[model samples]
Target: LSVVQDQIDDLKISLNISLRIVLIGKTGSGKSSSGNAVLGWSEFKSDLSQTSVTKLCQKAQGRVEGRRVEVVDTPGLFDSTMSHHEVNEEMLKCISLLAPGPHVFLLVLQIGRFTPEEKETLNLIMKAFGKDAQKFTIILFTHGDKLEDYGLSLEEFIQKKCDDSCKKLISDCGNRCHVFNNKEKDTERKYIQVRGLIKKIDDVVRANGGGCYTNEMLQEMKRKMEEMEEKFKQEMQKMQQRMEEQRDENEKVLQERDNELKELKTNIKRERTLREEEQKNCNLFFHNITIIGPYFQKCAKMNQSFAQK
Candidate 1:
């Protein structure tokens, strides 16, 4: 009974364990096909077009060798003619699809098609995703038929055909690479490739402390967003304070003006009263002068008559 219980418990634990992978690359680099091959089904749309085929991110879930596996297929990272904003938006969506994050990033590359543009795209991926991405990244090469045509193994191809920068990129990824031939219909080959890829992913996970790839760029973005929110809050507070101060200043000015108006009115009333009093005195003086003038004239006339007599 104890042995049976332990077996059941182990099975449960195995069922709970899952592997998440995110595929990223430029247009026509066979990312979608590679994803389908990895999942052992045609879950993602694969095509050979002059333009980008995968316009959005797609996620597919499956069980491989008793392990739950989830693969995220993303649009080409750096499609020519796409604006930076558009690319960034799509990349952000890819990250969101990965949710908490991915266990490994499959940087898809075409076998024998490494160009200067592809090199630049790789650099862009490193720059945009951050340096930490390399720790959990695997350089997945698609179109493995190219290797057969050249009669070379993957190692031979990388050694002879790849340039210095390409070699460095592989080295940076810890030389973690795998080749898949999506065109091949052999079930055994497919199984072997998928198994090998999953094993490599397991190895990477174990080597990296059993943790998924840490999205430092995403974390940094979150931190920056928090800072921006804080800044916005501070600015709003400052604006509110300024508005309050302006209101108080305006009230003070209005109060001062009202006080000045009241003083002017009082002065006007006082001046009017003084003018009235002055006018009354002037009237009284005018009346007295008229009567005295008449009296003086009569006295002068009497004196003249007495002198004549």
Candidate 2:
């Protein structure tokens, strides 16, 4: 009975693992600051130049409402004045190592200026990931002080800049977006809001990745393999078509030669038959003719026949 009870307890403990939330955005988006805020400690390095603070992913493990929360900080991605495509590629490599897979995407941004570049970054993220991204994403806008003086709410700001791309991203993320001011005094309130966001994202994580958040890596690899297979198949089809066309051309040439051979054989047979018929007619005429004359007359007749005939 004790052993059975121990197994039951183990199952309960396994059911309560913390969720992994990954922070992604351009440099100076305040990801490190936001991570410090979330973890309630200055464990991660923050306050770097506009280029980037977090060169690699740094993880901070913490507790909120009796559940463990993992915060993954990443470097800036696709900053026109800052990072390059190589940088983004490197960050993906880092993400693969650090988080393996993440249940939530915390996109840090400044409130006062939702620049076109920032919007584009979000679009890029969606394009890279695919529809699965919708399950585990929440927008976390930093620099809330910039919004204090502004009268418009976050939804209003999004609506003002609504396009098909932005609309689709919002819709895919389950209409989940949050704005947090790192410098604000009511940080616990923001934490509660963020806590809810984590829970929501966790539900998606369990549903999509077989309770393993790192399944994105597997899915990405699978997608690449499928693309390669399709390309290979297309090339094989082209090769087969070329071979068929060549075979048809070769067959046509052989058929023409065969026809010419048949015609030549027919002409030879007709000429041979004509020659035999003429020989038979000449033999009959020679047999039917009778000549008895003097040698001189015969010789003259034969000479004349030879000359005339």
Candidate 3:
């Protein structure tokens, strides 16, 4: 019983090993289809149109071969139709979805369809994922039927047909590659390929000391966001301070205006009193003059009358 319990504990430890994978590519490079294949179901929307279908980062989780698997399907990273700003916004979403970080990045490519558009796809991937991304990346090729039809293996195709840029991309990814045929009706083959891909990822994780891929770019982004938050707080404090100062200044001006108004009212009252006093004095003088003039006139008339007598 003790041995059985120990085995159970070991199994639990193995089961707890989680694998986080992020899929990236251009529009219609079979990113969604590859994600569906990896999940062993049609959890993601896959189409063959030239336009982009997945507009955001979508995550799906399931158990694969006793290991927990989480896949994040991101929008096309190098869609020419999308502006740089739009691509950047989507890339940030992808990074956020992979939070903490991703263990592997599956760069999907369609076999026999490597065009100039695809050539620049790697540059975009590196730009988005950072320089150290190649260490944690795997080149996943879709449309395996093309290779089967041509009777050539992925190795042969890469050696004989791939351009300099494609070869360089494969070399950058440590030559790690896997092929998948979503259109294949063989369930057994699909399962085998998915298992093989997972094994490859496990080997990569082991090689990297069981640590996920992280780069200066991601760290810089986090740093910038922190700095931005601090800056915003400082700016808000400054704005509040300015507003308070303005309020104080306005209050002082209002107080000064009120004081001036009160002084003007007092001056007006004093002037009015002075005017009233002057009017009263003038009236008294006129009244005295009238009384004196009448008395003088009567005296003069009496003198003239006595002389005539």
Query: Which tens-of-lDDT digit does each residue in 175-261 have in candidate 3?
Result: 999988878888898899899988888767765656676545577745776798899999999999999999999999999999999
CA lDDT scores, all candidates in order: 0.81, 0.68, 0.81
lDDT of 1 by residue, 99-160 (tens): 66787889999998887777765566655565567787999999999999999999999999
Ranking by TM-score: 1, 3, 2
Which is the winner by lDDT between candidate 1 and candidate 2? 1
Model 3 RMSD vs true structure:
12.3
lDDT of 1: 0.81
Clashes of each: 0, 0, 0
Q: Which parts of model 2 have CA positions greater than 4 angstroms off?
A: 1-14, 80-85, 94-100, 126-131, 160-165, 206-212, 220-222, 225-309
